[model samples]
Target: VQISKKKFVADELTEDGYSGAEVRVTPTRMEIIMLATRTRAALGEKGRRIPEWTPVAQKRFGFPEGSLCAIALRYKLLRGLAVQRPCYGVLQFIMESGAKGCQVVRAKSMKFVDGLMIHVGDLVNYYVDTAVPHVLLPQGVLGIKVKTMLPWDPTGRTGPKKPLPDHLSIVKPKDEILPTTPILGQKGGKPEPPTMPHPVPTA
Candidate 1:
C-alpha cells in the first residue's frame, strides 16, 4: 500500500457535529482526518460506526479498500446559536475553551450589550471560525454572526510561533449560556493580547 501521490482538502465538508476534514498519505496508508464537535458522534463509540461514511468517501475519492483510515478530532462553535442569552453562552464557552478572544454580532434591535455587539464588518473571508445562523425575530428574520480567536495551529506541527489576531484564530463555544466577557466585532476596539500556546503538534 505504498502511495505514490496524495491529496488534502481543508474545510470543504461540514455536517451535523462535523466541522471539517483533511486527507493525508504515507507510504503505508492513507489517513482521513475528521474534525467534529463530538468525536464519539463523528467516529462513533470505539469507531464502531465508521462504515457509515467510509465507503462513501472511498468511492467518492477512489481510495483503495483497507488503505483508508478514518479518525476524528473535536472542535466547538461548529453549529449556529439561537437568540439573546444563547449568544452570551457562546462567548463564555469560547473563552473558557482556551480562545484568545471572542465577539458576537446581530441586528440593532437585539443588542446583547450596549456597544459590545454593535460593530459590524464584511467577515465573508475572515480566517477565524465563524457562524452565521439565522434566527426568527418578532420584526423579521436576522442573522447572528459569531467570531472567536482560538489556540489552534493550522499547520498541525509545532503550533504557531507568533500570536494570531482575533480575526485569524479559531474558537469554541459550549451549550447556550450567557457569556460574561463583552463581545468584540470587526470594527470594535482592540482586545487584550492573547498568550501564545505551547509549541506542540496539532490535528
Candidate 2:
C-alpha cells in the first residue's frame, strides 16, 4: 500500500490487513513519505507543500517517479529551528558506535535565530557518518543528550532543553559501551573505547 502524499497531512491512514512497512526502507525506496507535523507547519507558513519528491535523491538512488519523499524532519538533534540553516557539529557522545545508530550531538559551529544564540546540551540526532564508515558521533570530551526532531515542537523555544535529547527514544542504546575518539583520530585520548564490538585498552 502507498502512503498519502497530501500536503499538511497529520498522518496518512493506510489500509488495514496489509503489512505496513515490512522493512525499514531508506528515504529513497519507499512510496510513503513520513513527515513531522512541526515541519509541515513551518513550511506551510512559507506557502510550501509536503509529500514532495526529492530531486537529488532521485538522481542518487534512481527510484521510481513520485516514489520518494522530501520530508522536513525536525532538527532537534542539530539545533532548534535555528536560522533554518544547516550547522556543522560532531558527536560528543554516541549511544551506539560501529553500527547504524542515532547521533548524539553538539554544535561545532554557532548561529543566531529569533534574536538568540543557541548552544549545545544533552541532545542528539541521527546521521550516517560517511567518513568513519560506521555510525559515528561528534568527537569531543563532553557528553550531551539530544532528541529527534519530532512531529511537533512542544517547547516552542529554539534552544536545547536541559533534559536528555529526544531522538534517543527512536533508537534505544544497547547494553554495549561506546568508546571515545579524539579529534583528527588521535589514539592518546580516553582510557577505553567501548563503542566497538570489542574493547581496546588505551596506552
Candidate 3:
C-alpha cells in the first residue's frame, strides 16, 4: 500500500508529424484524487462573491451586472461542504486499510436540496501476504460523506430524511449532461452557435 509517484517514457506526436520521446508521468491514485478535489475547490470559489462591473466577471459568468445570482449561490453552497478535505481523507483511509490499488469516481449535481452534492466511491482491491496462505480479497466499495455544519445549528442536525431524486442519484460521469448544455440550448434541442476559435499564432 505504498503510495509514490512514478514516471515513464512515451512517444508523442507533434503537429509537424514528428514523433519524439516524452516523459509521460502517471500519478498514483491518491495524487490524482487529491489534485482533482483541490481543483474543484478552486473552481467553486469563482462565484463566492457578487460580481461588479468588470471584464473578469463578464468573462467568467458572462454577466458583468452580477445578474447570475444562481451561480454565486451554488458556489457558496459547495464551499460550505469543503469537498477537498473529505475526499482526500477518504483516499488516505483506503490506503491505510491495506488497499494496494484504488480508483475514485466523483459525482457532482445540483439537484439536491442543499444545492450541490458531491459523492465519491472508491473501488479497491487488496491482497494479504502471510505465512499461512496468500489470499486475494474481492473488490470493495467505500463511500465518502460530506456534511455541513450551520452556525444556527451547532449540533449538526439534519432535516427530515428523504430519498434522493432520480436526477440526483449517483451516476457515471459519461452519462451526465454537460453543465453548459442548458445555457447553450434547451434540453434535447439544437445547441447554440459555436464560439469562434482563437487563431493560432504563427512563427
Candidate 4:
C-alpha cells in the first residue's frame, strides 16, 4: 500500500476464488494538502534545523532558559499546543531550592479541567505526620473535601471567572474511629501478672 498526498492506493492480492483488484482512497482536497504540507514541513530541512538553535535563539523559539526544550517540541508536535510561556517564579523555584514561586500555581494545570467529578459535601481525607498530630494543609493538596463549589463567578458583580486561580477552599475530614468493646482487663484496669503456684503439700 502506498499513501500519497491525495489518496491511499493498494494492490489487492488474488487469494481463494477472488480476482486481484486495485484499491484507492482519496481524501478531501483540503485535508490532503494540509496533511502533505505538514508532512513535508516535518520531514524536510526545517525539522532538522529546529533543534540547532542556540540557547538564546531557543528562548525566542518559545522555550525558557534552563527548561526542557524537548518538552516544548513534543507539546507542539504531539499535542498541537503552543509551548508554555515561562513562569519565572516557577523557573526560579526549580533552579534554586529556597526560591519561592507564585502564590497559587499548579504543577500541571493543563491536564485537569473544570467540572471534575468531586462534588460539594463529599468526604475527603488527608494525612499528617506521626510526630505532628495536627494537619498541615499545603497550597494544592488533593483528597480535600470541597467546601463550596462556586459557579464560574461567585456573584454577578464580578466579571467572568478567569481560568486560573481556582476558587475552592478544601478542608480535611474529621477522623472517625469505630467504638470497640474493651477486653475485661484491657482498659481502666491492670492485667494480672503471672503468679507462681503455691508449693504442693507433700503426699
Q: Which candidate number maximizes TM-score?
A: 1
Largest lDDT belongs to which candidate? 1
- Per-residue alpha-carbon lDDT of candidate 3 for residues 1-203, written as tens digits (9 for 90 to 100): 11221111011112223323322222311211112223433233453222231234346333311122222222333445453543444344434533332222233331112222223322111111101111122333222222221111223232113322332555566676557633656776788787999999999
Candidate 2 lDDT over 31-53, as tens digits, reads 33334434444334332332232
Worst 10 residues of 4 by lDDT: 126-135
Please provide TM-scores, in order, for all candidate models, with all chains considered together: 0.30, 0.16, 0.16, 0.16
Model 3 CA deviation exceeding 4 Å by range: 1-79, 108-203
Kindly report which residue pairs in candidate 1 clash with one another. 88-179, 89-177, 150-170
Question: Candidate 1: lDDT over CA atoms?
Answer: 0.45
Better of 1 and 4 by lDDT: 1
Local error of candidate 4 at residue 73 (angstroms):
4.5
TM-score of 1: 0.30
Cα lDDT, all candidates: 0.45, 0.30, 0.29, 0.28
Better of 3 and 4 by lDDT: 3
Clashes of each: 3, 23, 0, 0
lDDT of 1 by residue, 70-118 (tens): 1111111122323544556545645565555556666545534221221
Q: Which 10-residue span in candidate 3 carries the lowest summed lDDT?
A: 124-133
Model 3 per-residue lDDT at 62: 38
